[model samples]
Target: MRCWAIIPIKGKGEGKTRLAGVLSASERDALVDAMLAHVVQAAGQAGSIERVLLVGPSRHGLDGAIPLLGDPGTGLNTALGAALDTASGGALAAIGAEGPDRVVVIAGDLPCVTALDLDLMAQVPAGTLGIAPDRHGTGTNALSLPLPDASRFIFRFGADSRALHQREAERLGLAVETICSAGLEKDVDEPADLTDAAPVFTPAR
Candidate 1:
């Protein structure tokens, strides 16, 4: 099946405010950059994924290698809406040629996510929604679905996202499957999350 990845990134000094006490402004930005790079690389490495969309503030300085979409500079949910639009063409191709039965949405903060996680999520049966909650079981760290329009969910990346997503799916008459994926559940949002995620980027054991 053909797959695509949509990663939404908030500009430095604009995200992960909870970790500010533990990391300097530069440190937090660096961590975000690293996580984004890792996720993009993993998507590129995944055989099933044909495209990766990096959406963020137009001025965000990501190295030239990654394709970036200029967002309208709004809330996280709005940025995500734009990102999904950017991925539409690829989504259409996947559906028509590559079997767009499902597309994976992963946050840029998930440093621990690996190709294996992608493979597992890809297995979600057609017409089903798969979600991996954050450690708090409130936010959704990763979600996969074959819905023709993923934007219908209206993502709001906050404490109640897990419940919200499920609610949205239920309202749409979509079946939801919650998975306990370690890599997908772990996100670098707090200082502890960053510390825990550092090893994933280090040389393999």
Candidate 2:
């Protein structure tokens, strides 16, 4: 199946605000950059993913050829929804394709995410919704939606999002398959989350 990955990322010097108490502003900024780069590399390396699209400002400074879409200066849910609509509605025409068979939406803050983890999510059965919940199994870290089947699925990224996404998949009449892996489950959010991403916070990068 032709799989595409959509990563919703904040612009430069953004995100990781919850860790402000533990990390200095500069430290948080570096960590955010590191994690976004890691996620983008992983998505690009995934053999099952045909393309990797970023939804955010174009100021990430990734030092690579990447396609970026404007964030619309709104919440993540709204940003991601617009990205999906663009990917499925008419943007494919520009790429000389109809649409992807599977669409994988992965958060940009997952420093631990790997190509294999993304591949696992993309390989879910047709008509199945693949969800990778956070380590606590409460929030969602990554998702794989089967084509037009889930093109309009709502994104619930906050509290209980894992369960909320599952319910949304059911409402869309798609089977739910949970992809659990260390790489896909870890996401740094707060001061307590720093330990999980300590290796990824190289400020000199």
Candidate 3:
């Protein structure tokens, strides 16, 4: 199957605002870039994924090679939906390649994400949806969707996103597979969240 990974990032200096009390602006930017680089590497290494696409205000110099889709200045869900629409519209075919059979939307803050974690999501059955929830099992950390089938799937990235995404899948008659793994659970958000990815962060002082 031709699978692709899409990672959406906030503009370079604007992410991880919840940790404002603990991290300097430069520090926060570095952390965001570091974590994003990690997620991108994992996706590139995943055996099932054919290519990686980024959607956001900027690529933040993480990798000049991967293509980026500009964010519509709306919100996360809208930006993601636009990306799916672009892919499903034959952007690949225009380049003499087959369109992606599946697309996985992965949060850029997952510091510990690995290729195996990504492969698990990419391997979900053709008619099923894969969700990797946060450490609290409340937020959605990553989503694996079969293409064309889930072309119009709405992304609910806010509170209770995990359950809500599952419901969204059910609404489309797709089976939901909750893939919980350590690598997929740790997304650095609050100050306390720093513990989940201490190795990637420099000393606050």
Candidate 4:
């Protein structure tokens, strides 16, 4: 099956605001850029992922190889829905044509995400949905859905999103596979999160 990974990123000025207590304006911008680069690199390196779609404001300084789907400047769910629509609407023709299509939505702030984590998420059986919750196990850090059925579940990304996603999956009668991976769980949101992620945020030598 063909797999497409969609990463939703906010504009530089609008992102990582929660970490303002520790990171300066420039530092937060750099951190967001670095994390975006790392996420894209990891998705590109995943053997199961055929394409990487960036759903965000603009792709000016990002890696040119990955495709960008301009966000509608709405909420997270709306942007994600737009990305999914684009992917399912002929952008990824091979997915449903040959076999089942897999769509993976991941947070751009997961600095520690690796190709292995992506590969594991992609390994979910056909007709099943995979979820990787955040470090605290309350928020969803990553999700894998098998389309077109994937559209049934609404994207509720916030406090207790993991439970919300699971309930949505159950409502749709889709088998839920909860995946736990340290690389996929860690996310930089607060000053403390940044401190914990510092080891992985080193500048490329």
Task: Give each model a TM-score.
Answer: 0.84, 0.93, 0.95, 0.90
Give the per-residue lDDT digits (tens) of candidate 3, residues 49-114. 998999998888967878888799899999998888877873655334567889999999998889
What is the lDDT, from 0 to 100, of the residue 160 in candidate 3? 99
* Top of the candidates by TM-score: 3
lDDT ranking, best first: 3, 2, 4, 1
Q: What value does the lDDT take at residue 87 in candidate 3?
A: 76
Clashing pairs in 1: 94-100
Query: For model 1, what is the C-alpha lDDT against the true structure?
Result: 0.71
Off by over 4 Å in 1: 58-65, 89-101, 149-151, 200-205
RMSD of each: 4.2, 1.9, 1.5, 3.0
Per-residue lDDT for 151-203 in model 2, tens only? 88999988999999999999999999999999999999877777778667754
For candidate 3, the 10 contiguous residues with the lowest summed lDDT are 89-98
In candidate 2 the C-alpha lDDT for residue 74 amounts to 76
Which residue pairs show collisions in model 3?
A: none
lDDT of model number 2: 0.86
Better of 2 and 4 by TM-score: 2
Sort the predicted structures by TM-score, highest score first: 3, 2, 4, 1
